[model samples]
Target: MSFDKFKPKYKIHSETENYFKLRAEAGAKPYDQLTVEEAREGNIANAKRFAGTTEFEGTVKEFTVPSKQCSDGIPITVYRSKQCDLCVAPSVFVYFHGGGNVVGCRQTVDTICRIFSRDAPCVVVNVEYRLAPEHKWPANHEDAICVVRWVKMNKGLLGAVNRSTVGVGGDGEGSRMAALVCHEVPDLGYQVTCIFHASAA
Candidate 1:
């Protein structure tokens, strides 16, 4: 006697297949949808959060990192305190401004940087990276890294930061940029002692 085997066949539902295809097509990351203005607003909110209870009641020295172009180049505003013991600080904080990568400047975050400078008494390098829509993605990241690397290379010329200890930090989009710089630019040859990301987006 021979036994017959039955095979089960299933129908392909067009609706289900279409639904899955649509989902796969929409699998992009959420950030891909954010507008420049929305990103900027988010960064500002993050900056406010980082500008915490720290206060400054001391003298500060203003210094700039030299640059070729001012439009979308990396510029730095340093706030230094006479009371700082740079030799022992073990880290200089290079701060990137928070403007959602769009509309903030060194002037906007001056007070906050000064406060950090006074409180920590370490060199505070406030970076002015390029904004979005005009200067997006790697532009901002490159600017931030360039400034930090330059400072690290010519610490004596800069005269404000401690060469021994250099830290890169920022808030929101700035924070994201700072992290990228820290991770990639090894030639800066500075260790990231601490990253102060005040509400990073």
Candidate 2:
């Protein structure tokens, strides 16, 4: 049977519905809500908050940008592809995964990245930054910066990603990173053409 046909609908708890109603009355719009700017901030916050809540547990592949020396470490667990194309498509999207600056992994965001790669017909880089509590504030941020820099430095390794047309997005804590990266576009010598922050805590 088709999965959609066999899909089951579980009833939501009354309390849950009530809570949602309360929020709706309080000027909360879950779908198609808020202006572009407002949504951007809210989503970024959610990505940052839910950093340690979700994950991807399964077989995974690894990609490395090996350093020339022992000090130049470079190997990232890739959850998506970065094949270069020869066409003049659009820009690339460098994504950051959310894990509250604590948990979560690149595998957690793999599926989404694949979809994005196909849909946007552009390059997508899912940054694997260091977690927090063990690293702290600038730790993850620094990792993010480095990853973006690496992508730019090695765009050829990335799938035909147009360096001029780049975007950054994230979930919860990742969303926070996305926003920060977006703002630092000029400073990073990268013009983050677009920014999307979703359900960011």
Model 1: per-residue Cα lDDT over 1-201, one tens digit each:
101231134554666445435434544223345565654554454446444445565444445555553443555776665546544543467887665566667765777777767766667788777777786577777677678777787665444444456777776667777778867777443333333322222
Q: How many backbone clashes does candidate 2 have?
A: 20
lDDT of 2 by residue, 125-159 (tens): 76767665555678677666666666666655554
TM-score, per-candidate, Cα-based: 0.59, 0.55
Task: Report the Cα lDDT for candidate 2.
Answer: 0.54
Query: Per-prediction count of colliding residue pairs?
Result: 2, 20
Error of 2 at 31 (Å): 26
